[model samples]
Target: MAKTWFITGASKGFGREWAEAALERGDSVVGTARNPDDVQALVDQYPDTFLAIRLDVTDRAADVAAVQQAAEHFGRLDVVVNNAGFGHFGMVEELTEDEVRAQLETNFFGALWVTQAALPIMREQGSGHVVQVSSIGGISAFPTVGAYHASKWALEGLSQSLSQEVAGFGIHVTLVEPGGFSTDWSGPSSKHSEELDAYADVREAASKRPSASDPGKPEATRSAILKVVDAEQPPLRVFFGKAPLGIAERDYESRLATWREWQPVAEEAHGA
Candidate 1:
């Protein structure tokens, strides 16, 4: 069956890769980007199967309208990929209030609004998939990217709850926790705050850590996503890279250990 996919931020990075893969598989796609022109090449290539639309996911009303329009145009939507977001790099103290708010608005609230719009359509049809693009930072924190981590963590929580609520309606939700890829996420797509000397040591240590930009490949991510889309029973949450997979495993283990270590203290608070 050829599914109709509605993907946000489809002009570049993982979003673009997903769109291309779908079209190659003879699926119909409604690709949304802030600048429609950015995705024109795809429209040109897959003239009958692809529709490029201009959209800013932050605008709730506009996003709803676009989703509705895409569904109407395709006659039905089988998948909704909320892949529209950017990375914000800076220590929490260094980032301004507006910067933090902007990060949350696009990364967390943007996905929320898109999900709200897509749910009714999916519920009516009784079948659809919603893919939320999060990051390893959603589960584990790192220096210099605190704001980005916070936004992804919020997204992770929202997608987890959404999966439970929509399962009865035959609507599936997948939270993709990708570590790093050879994309513009850390380069042209990311926003950086003014550096402060007070955090020099921490920043230096962070810089010494392995770079996310050169490790993962976008083609591999595209293939993994396609598999998830085609699965009869996809996982609620999946890690996309070796780094993310290992990080998540270690993080949960550490969390469990800490909880057990303090279990007595926690139980004593109840006065039992």
Candidate 2:
């Protein structure tokens, strides 16, 4: 029962790892990166199971073409992993219009565009799994990463609604909420806006705060994601990292408490 997968951002991080896992499971993958050559090394490792492709998920026209190419090459695509994303760290007030646009373009609208193109094929086949490599940033707020959080938050909402909309078509959508890992994320992929440097004193302190980059923390992310990829029926949300697990839980608890106390008000809003 081998399956075919189309995964974005396969050059590194969770994308590369997930591509490995999928191949290990005997699945064929069309692993995509901005520079398809970036994945040549991976392609060399698993020649038969992987196809490297260049993809900029933000380009709607090109994205549709990529999906069509995958479906044609693989004959059918069973899984779509939207893992291409980046972070923009800066206070909302400190960010520029261009920086905000770039943040949302890659993290939010890119996923949306890819999903829109992939849905037609999935609907035709009546089966597919769409995995979004999101972050805990989408679920909670933090200093300096407000712009990043906004993009992820938008993704969370879009993916959740997509899950409900595509359920009847046998398409499963899962959101992988990862905190951090031992990757080059802090490099260009996670950049700070220059305009925000005026608040450097405050932002510097925030940056020094504990993150998944701490020793031994990234391993937890690796293990958690592999677990999700192996699940027979993955949940709508798969939280990665020890810190994210706790953060997600607390967020859920507070949301539940609010719902409980305000059920009457909530119910009235919808006439429940």
Q: Score candidate 1 by TM-score against the native.
A: 0.98
CA lDDT, candidate 1, residue 46: 93
lDDT of 2 by residue, 105-127 (tens): 98888888888989999999998
Model 2 deviation from native, Cα RMSD in Å: 3.1
Pairs that collide in candidate 2 are: none
Worst 10 residues of 2 by lDDT: 212-221
In Å, residue 239's CA in model 2 sits off its true spot by 0.7
Alpha carbon deviation, residue 18, candidate 2 (Å): 1.1
Candidate 1's residue-wise lDDT over 127-201, tens digit each? 999999998888899999999999999999988988999999999999998887888998999999999999999
Query: Least accurate stretch of 10 residues (summed lDDT) in model 1?
Result: 207-216
